[model samples]
Target: MGLVRNRVGLPAKCDLQIKAKREVCSFEFHSVPGDKSISQRAIVLNAIAEGQGTVYNVLRSRDIESCITILRQLGVRIAWNGDELSVHGQGLRGLQAPAGRLEVGNTATSARLMLSVLAGQSFAAELGGNALLSARPMDWVVQPLTDMGAVIEYLGAKGCLPLRIQGASPLSPIDMEATVFSAQEKSALLFAGLYAEGITRYRQRCQSRDHTERLMHYFGIDIHSDNDVTFLKGGNAFCAKDVMVPGDMSSAAFLLAAYAIRGVDRKGSLLIKQVGVNPTRSGFIRLLAEMGLHLTLQAEAELISGEPVADIYCTPGTRLSSVLAEGNGRIQSLIDEVPLLAAVSAFAEGNTVIRDCGELRDKDTNRIQTTAGVLKAFGVETSCSDDEMVIHGGRPLSPAIVNSCGDHRIAMTAAVLASSLDEPSIIRNCGCINVSYPGFVEDLSQFAHIDVLPAE
Candidate 1:
């Protein structure tokens, strides 16, 4: 494989060098990063619980850091000693008014979930983020919280951040009907419902990630799910306890994809330890298996904090074929991995269609367009519409410079794709990978020859 460089000559935090068709002759065991979703939820719930709580194996990334920073601004006492995070819960109504606006950085998870928590407080505060976050819509949470009698005003463009919220001491119970299958929206409402006067019922056509529900149950909160609906009664007390966050499945998806695309050639097997395989978030594994990837679940599968945990083993499959990924109710489970999946589709035998995923456009960047752009740069035939992406597979990828668009998933996906190609490809804005998987370059380096250098 030959090396390629970016033509823009822009300075970057990290540049990756991936040798194509690299073979790994030895078995590999990797301990991926802790689950960011669970870590964020644990931090928020622990801060509002009734006593002191400890979270182990929490991810140390920019996204998690944003959550910690906002919690501290709201009077939650949080301390980090290496891998252990300790939080002193002040109870549901115990949060003090922030002295200044809460800066959420570029994390939509922090912005949306924290917005709901702020709605039940008794003081007024402002929520803000970076330029990228400021462009993503916040109306999904704002509209529902407003219906429950929480006063929120958009400080910037309508339906987006920065938001000025005047909280209600006793929020009104809401019968919310979800218009989209979004985990962030559902979790936000459930979080705010803790302060309502009666039961807050959320009904959706499809299920999203249930981390909030599971963590609530783990912390002794009263929450239940019926068909198409999750209801939480207000005034339930949360008891503080220690939580051990499992390894992030989303981060593991990149590794799994790398092995799926190249393991047959490398003649090696990969084992990822202590990964959270929550059914609602395991769509990547399920979908990849359907597309002819061989994966095994170790016998140690168990439950952690009401979530499923297991070790994932990946090996090369006999053949690769295309599969359909529609944006039905199940899209929430695999939303973060769609970009990586699209990249892998380049190695399949037939056309892969990803439809009904217009929601990808609303992320940190236009993921559907960005995913297609990356594949196209590598000489793959791809096309994208408002709600669908089609990748014509069976074509060998060529070396070319690809842009990460300042998005972490895209950066990691590009790196994975580059590793499988026959020539070297440059990934611009590679440092954005730190937002979710700061250790991605380091972890992937174990299996392949990679070099990290300054962009220019």
Candidate 2:
């Protein structure tokens, strides 16, 4: 209950307070958005290829919608009903030049991937995005595609967006090494490799998500990876299949973190069913499990949809141990979950050192810095370098006002911290949760005391 104002005799702002319950409460069932990353890739690949394909369980987020809009501008017909999306793909040589500029707002994947394909076309196309996307580094995508004989001209800043890709003759395949560990950059090259004259091979310094490769294979595109090197030969036809996108594991991270921190009852432990559990993207889960989280993976199966799916059941369990993030697939898989994992570390017993995630430093470095700042704001002692964060754990967390910085993972992470508190904690700029899971606040309201307040 909020304090009443005596002068006006009316209620003022609502104050949220978490009360201690005698019994433990847990979540039994919950569902999140359709895989946003997968949906974006599915739409882009199917729309640009030479087949009529149906994509089911597509996420209807703002980013994905931007991709669809761009595809439509490129003369691809898209029919969508709820989560079911059908793309009448324009063949390799089927695209017509759009009359005006095509804008992709804050969707880096859409902007980057489409730029690669547009490079292979024979028309001049301009691509731009919102402030955030414009500020994102495109040189990783630009340099590789340019080396493949795509002439891209940057109109605004060097190696940034508001760029123009004047379609020139597609060049023969060239072996290149990806400098940054960005899945989008790798996928962009691979997508261009689909139309290259000869074989195109990509060697990466670090492994990123392989959804693009998995989807290409599912579409009958031959893409082979030997160790860290991926080879894709040109002159191949893509056979589209009916893809069923599972729930996004990234989105599920918040629920698992909340349940772990809040200590849900046995019966109410939220069953996040049928989520994409591709081994390449399970680093966070692996870390949590290593830290002693009571997580269960059931009905695990491989899908020809280019990704893997399984049922993830997470209930309340003992506090986890501090985990040191090692190299290999761990950093690449959980690139987006670093913030939440950092919060998880706050409750652990030892020192947690997350290292070798330098690639993440390219994008949202401020978020990483802000995450460390928030930990300090919450009374948790932490330190972070450019590429790593070391958090000393087993510290008591007190209620404090924290800023989300408009990052979805950070916002949800703050909410998870709120759930564990006996007192009220205010989260400003937390509305960014809609970037992925729009129902976050509504769904969370069922479990904890949450009041959605405007940023003051």
In terms of lDDT, the best-performing candidate is 1
For candidate 2, lDDT tens digit of each residue in 121-168? 888899988776777798878987888888889999999989988765
What lDDT would each prediction earn against the true structure?
Answer: 0.84, 0.76
Q: Mind sharing the TM-score for model 2?
A: 0.91
For 272-374, candidate 1 gives per-residue lDDT tens digits of: 7788999899998998889998788894665658877888876776788899988665567798998888988998999999887888899989999999999
Candidate 1: give its CA RMSD in angstroms.
Answer: 4.0
* Model 1, CA-based lDDT: 0.84
Q: Candidate 2: worst 10 consecutive residues by lDDT?
A: 1-10
- The positional error of residue 385 in candidate 1, measured at the CA in angstroms, is 0.8
Clashing pairs in 1: none
The TM-score values for the models, in the order shown, are 0.95, 0.91
